[model samples]
Target: MASSTIIVMGVSGSGKTTVAEGLARRLDVPLAEADDFHPPANVAKMSAGTPLTDEDRAPWLDALGAWLAERDLAGGGGVMTCSALKRRYRDRLRAASPDVFFVHLTGDFDLIERRMRERKGHFMKAGLLRSQFADLEPLQPDEHGVAIDIGPAPDELVERAAEAVQRA
Candidate 1:
């Protein structure tokens, strides 16, 4: 089997990190958190409860693309977390690494909002959730990915994601 890059994506509070960490462990690959790739300005803006514009995201996406490219060139697989709220963003990633696959974690607004509100020390505020949802585009039919509901526990969700990745 070819090495595969798995991008665990979703809006804030949708369990991207948790799922990605689990998948990384299950797949025995390194885990990259997209938040760490953000520029300080982006982090400050998000911390101030401002949603990032495309302009603000360009360099960040490029950095992530570079990471994917590095993995691809090395012929290794890994998992990463990203908001990837728009098709264009995912497209950028796919352009960098053709074999990239996505695991989109989704849940109801109320559930996500509660989670965000309870999360501490995270730069993303609950107020920004609406903007995230507004910008989100679900994975299209042509996309190589899986959409898993966020209702399950972390372990179960990882199991499902692992199974899905195998199938893909």
Candidate 2:
């Protein structure tokens, strides 16, 4: 039931990459990090602690969507990490692959900020988390996904996401 492609989505500090990595391993599918799809200009701006506008994200989203489409075309599936903070962005991805299912990671701001602070070498610093939260729109009822709490350890979170995908 369209569980082939899974998207681990949340704000910048919600442990999307970590959980997605584990999920991909658990699911035995390819995985992609949304950051890798960004253009140099976009990465430069974000690395400077600036929040990206929708305009800056469009092309990046398109590229990531295309990647999903390619995986789907191959008759297998994959997992990916994406901030997908807005519904419109998720919509763009869905357009590329209608079966795309999202695993929305959610947690307290305090926990997320602490996570962002502790992580190293990430372009998205702790300062931008507030902006991401401000822009975040939780998955609606119509969306094909579940909201997962990020309080548990990363492995636990991944397990929860994997279970959700199977159920989907």
Candidate 3:
């Protein structure tokens, strides 16, 4: 199969980092975290429990796209995390790498909120989950990716996503 940048996307607390890490290892490719691409100002807003405006995310998305472009050009597509909750955001990544693939993690709101509350040392607060869900646009039929539910164990979910991503 042709290589394509894999974007592990979902709302915060949806195990994006976990799945991305495992998938990167399984695929033997480098990994990048979308959170690391965010500017300090954006992190501060989310830390304060305020939802980020589209303006706050533009630079972050561009940075991720650049990362994808770099890896795609290198002929070794890698994995990355992003709360690509909108179709337009995903489109921006696709513009950078036409074959970009998304592994969208989905789960019940209550379950995801519990994971967020249980997480520590993270800038994002559980309170902002509502805003994230409000902005989420799941993978469309025409999109080049798969949607995997987050209900299973972390390893199982990663295995399932890795298989789908590899097949695609």
For each of the candidates, give the backbone clash count: 0, 0, 0
Candidate number with the higher lDDT (1 or 2): 1
Model 2 over residues 27-135: C-alpha lDDT tens digits?
7789999999999999999999888989999999999999999988987799989988899999999999899999999999999999889988888889998898899
The models' CA-based lDDT, in order, is 0.93, 0.90, 0.92
**Model 2, residue pairs in steric clash:** none
Q: Model 1: which residue pairs collide?
A: none
Per-model TM-score versus the true fold: 0.98, 0.97, 0.97
lDDT of 2: 0.90
Q: Write the per-residue lDDT of candidate 3 for residues 1-168, one digit (tens) a residue.
A: 336789999999999999999988888899999999999999899999999998888988889989999999999889999989999999998999889989999999999999999999999999999999999999999999999999999999999997897688
Candidate 3's displacement at residue 110, Å, is 0.3
TM-score for candidate 1, please give it: 0.98
On TM-score, the candidate that comes out on top is: 1
